[model samples]
Target: MRTIVITGGTDGMGAALARHFLRAGDRIVVIGRSRAKFDALLATVTSDDRSAAARAEFLAADLSLVADSRRVVEHLQAKHAWIDALVLAASFIRQHRHITAEGREASWVLFFVSKYLFVTGLAAPLCAAERPVIVNTAVPGTRADAIDFDDLEMSEGFTFARSNAQQRRANELLGILAVTDNPDLAYVTWGPTRLVRSSFAGEVGKSMKIAAAVLGTLLGQRPDVAVRPIIGIVDAPTPGRAAYRGSKELALTVGDHDDEDAARLATAVEDQLR
Candidate 1:
């Protein structure tokens, strides 16, 4: 009987995770940007079992806004004092850079800003869990990239590849920092080998879409297969850094990129968040 909170829960990895967790009898709260999708998922969950009505709740907001992230934290905290797990599966992947109304790059806001606020804002509640876990979904694309401190939002020279890479890098650093700053909390930043076929990725530009399609067709694994290991990581007796491939732990952090680069990226992220 744990409370699990997932962003971007209306679809894709988030949705799949919600279903799996619900079936396992964990209370879940899902936040998404679409009311229709939220309602639709709620309807299905309720239909499966009326008890799901009591166990599950849905909220809709564009997380690109810091205010919205704050509101989400407040709303959920008001409902429950403790959260067993916080999974940030929401992502921003666009071919062209889009600016949020808040004057920050939309993709960066989604990947970095919203994620940071959610984790920091909910730290107390999440820490209340017997064994709390914070999981940030990331990819190998993060590599060993350097953060552009001068243009933190990538407003000056933005590209889909660079923006996505930076966010993935940020995810890794956040995991390390979260673990280091709060010794009681367990953190894991992992990437599945398969591309999750989700509406979230539908917003990619044409060329990128073609590239994704090709990669997905060639190397994509089913969503369930990709997410099973994450569930295991969440349920592990103790968590620090766990990587997985098809429910088996793999060495994604080993030799894929340089340790120095990852450390520098983590430091930059800490400074930017400060």
Candidate 2:
């Protein structure tokens, strides 16, 4: 049986994927923040102890902290020798800015710091496996501008739109780096065609919250449907590429300067993580 580690696996897209894989007989290790959500997900899987398909475990963590992220990887690696799949579906989206105790913006930390470290820490074990997949959950966001190298933390100016743009761009950059650094491991960043309805915006502005609620009501896809791309991504052919579920091309059209920007962004990420 394959072993998979999915962050934020207690809710939304992550939870949906976890449930799907559990039923498929894969061993899952879920990481999240809420003990209640974690317990609920575990209970669902282990409801019938006699069922062969149900097998899973969980670790509670606030992923916004890099130290927590390091601890999480250590915990997982210590428990398992190899991981068949690593899903980065847990994300941070917000209207107002929030910072972690590490002095980094929560959105940036979740989207960049934690994600980068988790992959780096797990790369060795993933490579040790016969075939391993790294699926990163990303959304198509505002990509007209480049990421701010000097003020990545958004200390100077933090706007919801700007942060979204930076995070999406960061995903592509990370994907490129993953392909370059670990050629033996397959990596894909999944971009869903529709929005995922998550309770991540509880602290968002009133207007933005209303907008999310309305959009969620009108156009959101079930987390299970949205996460289908993730399953497809993991099953895709070797020589890892970005994938859009039920779509043709694997590229995310950023801009004319995306190549240069991606290189710079990768360097920045490496430096920051170091």
Candidate 3:
């Protein structure tokens, strides 16, 4: 059985994927902020299958704090000999800018920076695995222009859509640069164009909740159907290529300058945080 570590596994697609993998007999180690919620999911996922529950593990962590990311990676590194796949599925979309103790916006820290930290810190186990894959659940709202090199933190003016698109772009580009560093591992960034009505969809306000539900009903697919691409991504082999997922094959594109951009992003964020 493949050993997979998933972030944001307590909710949204991560939780659905966790249950799916567990039922498929894979060892699932999930990271979230709440053990109580995890316990509830564990019960539902396991159901009558006690063995499946036993195969699953959960680590509670507030992923918004980059300071805690290292500890998370260290713990995972100590526990597992090799991580078959790392699913960077944890994300947040907030209407307002909330700066953390690290002085970076919470959206940037959670969606982009901490994701990079997880992969960089856990590079060892990832490389040691028979088949190493980094599956990033990235949204395709904005292109490369989303990142403001001058205001990476969006300190001047911020909108929820603007910040979310920026982080999503960062993650997609990060997959591009990450493959160069870890040639043995495959980096896949999933970009589902239609909304999936995830847990994060409704957390903002009532209007957003109604919008999400209506949009989901009209345009979005169920979690089972939407996550099929992700499952395929983990199962397939596409090393050193940053693959984008969508309905049409023509939409899948890669970048030639992602290495430089990823380096700039990495250095800027690391330096800023320090």
Among these predicted structures, which one has the highest lDDT? 3
Q: lDDT of each prediction vs. the true structure?
A: 0.74, 0.76, 0.78
Error of 2 at 33 (Å): 0.4
Candidate 2: residue pairs that collide: none
TM-score of each: 0.85, 0.88, 0.91
Candidate 1 achieves a global lDDT of 0.74
Q: Which pairs of residues collide in candidate 1? A: none
Ranking by lDDT: 3, 2, 1
- Where does model 2 exceed 4 Å of error? 48-54, 140-145, 245-250, 254-263
Better lDDT candidate (1, 2): 2
List, residue by residue over 210-252, the lDDT tens digit for candidate 1. 8777777787776766788778877873656554444555554
Candidate 1 displacement at residue 105 in angstroms: 0.5
Ranking by TM-score: 3, 2, 1
**Model 2 quality (TM-score):** 0.88
Flag regions of model 3 displaced more than 4 Å: 201-205, 246-256
Across 59-166, the per-residue lDDT of candidate 2 in tens digits comes to 888888888998998987788898888999776567779977887788988877788888878877787767788887765434637479877878988987788778
Worst 10 residues of 2 by lDDT: 241-250
Q: Candidate 3 at residue 131, lDDT? A: 79
